[model samples]
Target: MITLTGRLICADAAQAALVQLYLPDHIRLTRAEPGCLSFDVVPTSDPLVWQVNETFTDRAAFDAHQTRTRESRWFKETAHIRREFRIIG
Candidate 1:
């Protein structure tokens, strides 16, 4: 299994709004994907930050997630927003 942690920082109000609007679709797609063991989005106490946790069955699943997320319009729309991600075993 693999775990992914994502931290998103939205500095602009418009960017934040776009992130909020895109979140539901992101969650839905992640959860529905095959080999997805778990997916969660946690709002930080600071409104500008968001924490995402995801687990997948294996490397192939993780790669699939990458493909899907990269293809998503929401991801493209939010590309300008500051974000960081980490992967752990």
Candidate 2:
């Protein structure tokens, strides 16, 4: 299995708003992907930070997810936001 853990850090309220606006679609699409065992993005105690947790069947699945994300509206819209993440297998 492969897992990703992270936080999406928004610079300000405006950036955070973009997250709120796009996250549902992002979540839906990701969850619908094959080999996606689990996917979650949720707010932290700090409103500007969102915790991310994802699990996939293997490296191939994880890599595919990454590739798809780079081409997605979520990536384009939130490109300026900060991300602190790690991938584990």
Report lDDT per candidate: 0.91, 0.97
Q: Compared with the true structure, what per-residue lDDT tens digits does model 2 show for residues 1-89?
A: 99999999999999999999999999999999999999999999999999999999999989999999999999999989999999899
Model 1 over residues 1-89: C-alpha lDDT tens digits?
99989999999678889989999999999999999999998889888889989999999999999899999987898989888989987
lDDT of 2: 0.97
Candidate maximizing TM-score: 2
TM-score of 1: 0.93
lDDT of 2 at 34: 91
For all predicted structures, in order, the TM-scores are 0.93, 0.98
| Candidate 1, residue 87: how far the Cα is off, in Å | 0.3
lDDT of 2 at 54: 99
